[model samples]
Target: MELIARATAVVGGTIAFLRRMGSPAHQAFGATPDIPAARKQGIMTLKMPAAEGWKDGRLPVCAPGLKVNAFASGLDHPRWIEVLPNGDVLVAESKEQAGPPKTLMDHAAQATMRRVKAIGTSANRVTLWRDADGDGTAEIREVFVENQNQPFGMALVGNRFYLGNTDGIRVFDYVPGATALAGSGEPLVAFKPHGHWTRSLIVSPDGSKIYAGVGSLSNIGDQGMEAEEGRAAIWELDVATHEARIFASGLRNAVGMAWEPVTQKLWTVVNERDGLGDETPPDYLTSVVDGGFYGWPYCYWGKTVDDRVPQDAAMVAKAITPDFALGGHTASLGLCWMPDGTLPGFGAGMVIGQHGSWNRSKLSGYKLIFVPFENGMPRGPARDILSGFLSEDEKLAYGRPVGVTLGPDRKSLLMADDVGDIIWRVTGAS
Candidate 1:
């Protein structure tokens, strides 16, 4: 049995080595990347970091002049966060439900994820934490909301709270200073569940509208485009009337959305298609325009057509390019605006939580990264805000960060590390 397994691994490695022809990973950065020809999708190139918990009072290494501490721990896969005006922090705890594998590929993918402790039983609830004494620790913990459907994104608008579940958005009438949700939630909008199941929600700056991000149901429409209706786009719904419109389309997996403080333009981080090579079509951060069409099934990075999918030349022509490339298969998920002086040694920018890669040959993006913005546009390559999530050999992950948001105090940073089951708080190192 051991010999057979060894032979299988060797065969897989040889296949990957022979099929490797993508552009350099670094070449995939910046506004204009050198996208090379798409490589053949081999048996799947995977390098997953073992999800290990931090031991012996250890913590993630932050950039200079910043410090991090576990604001709350022992969570059941805390993947998203929202801080209330009263300084209460809400952590959404959930995990993917892959279900029984259907084929050899499915079984292998499931096994890889399971070995890394990625897939597990979903907690299906949101936990709230309160730091009453401003001591950088949460002395209070409670289940703020319960009976959610694989919740991910969270937002509290005025007296109402919104939760992004796998199938739709739920809104509840919230009471001030309340640690737990007092009322039952009602459906705000419905979505086709499965595939990329996590939906992210964010309120408009004026609080007049709510935007929900729905990702693709398949890697690149392998499940037929009709099955992808109402997915892979950001939907804007009126806060009062509940009227919704497809604000932007063709986003493969738009996860995180933010308003560029300087420009006030909508921005998002999208997970691009896989099997196209390590860096041929990189995931991106871009300003989403009203009715904007970003290439998903047809093209990427400014209409560079992906030849794999059945082409529609007209649809491909309408594809608008993304603003910046954020490394291929990085799975950049968490995004939040950080103003000038918000964090030490960092200017105004967007802070992203890269959930790390599962399909790339070499590991990428297992850290909290910051992309500096000058006048609301990405200025340069991303800088590490908090790193060392991976072990020295890069085969183990102490944590995988997801949602990022401003702390309840409005002066600190809060990040969720799902694998480590911890909600980390970041503040200046005074």
Candidate 2:
């Protein structure tokens, strides 16, 4: 065992050294010499193909094309968006500074929630925008909630709005005229604190359970997976009993989760383990099977062992490899399976938000992708749906799409650009 450990350590060290020396891992994933030269020659102007009917700075109309209108813009880091039944779009704007001081002895503790001198203010709040007037634009903008601590995912169920934050899940009464979230609602569930602190929440289709995507605090669970509560798993909580248990584990960072339309099966987009010189473990979008274990610290993408840790015997026995593997370091985010009989060609297709990458030397994934499906399974290659988020040179990206949803009209698509603070509506060609 010690020999195996030493050998793994040596391999890891060697990989790290090679990475520092500028290996192929530093280049864009699947980028060939011919591809870059062709791009330079204006062969492929952008990484992904432009959406159909998107010309003249006006979106094209679709088969059952609905009018595409902007609800809100000029938001600061708008993370998640939930559209209410009355056509009001609620946007969660996270701008949090470091919290108050924890102790005078350890005054230099620099954490967002920990007690540290506030370097600056964070905009942890929620905003609402509605097209009150028939102006085809969002004219009414109001602050719905304020003083939140890095809230991300939100789900609206009837008259209540469920919010998932770093601390726990909080419920707010959706008063039509309530300007702010000052009127306290009931606390649903308070999760045991763990790392990878972003806890994304979603309500089950039947509303019996609340599914929370809890990410591991560190890469490969170096913090000792046993010690961490709710890390690296999809946790399901009984909405009535408030009882929470692990639905699935070893998922590293399953940041995005949604339900398929026809199958009603739960699906997730995971940001897979990093390091390993970049290309070793590809991020994945897969259907989450209950009680399944996706090899995280032990293994990855099936058979590709992550050299960072010695294989745990028990975990190895329970590990179930991911169904589909996305490209390496793509930073897969919010996903929505297209409903059946919706768009003309996008029936039952999967739309995933690629939040772009920062770890790799060269950039990748700054647009939306469509993974077509047939008989409730992924069909062929995942095609780029909405391009132009990034430039051809790969130097800079204007917007990072985080959340995607079909508008109420079912024909138009609404994309939440977190960086650009804009919700873009793509209509069919005119």
| Number of colliding residue pairs in each model | 0, 14
lDDT of 1 by residue, 146-189 (tens): 88889998887889998999989999989998888876798989
Q: Which ranges of candidate 1 are over 4 A from the true structure?
A: 1-27
TM-score of each: 0.95, 0.77
Candidate 2: clashing residue pairs, number: 14
The global C-alpha lDDT for each of the candidates, from Candidate 1 onward, is 0.84, 0.64
lDDT of 2 by residue, 40-85 (tens): 1111111211112123464312223334445567776676777777
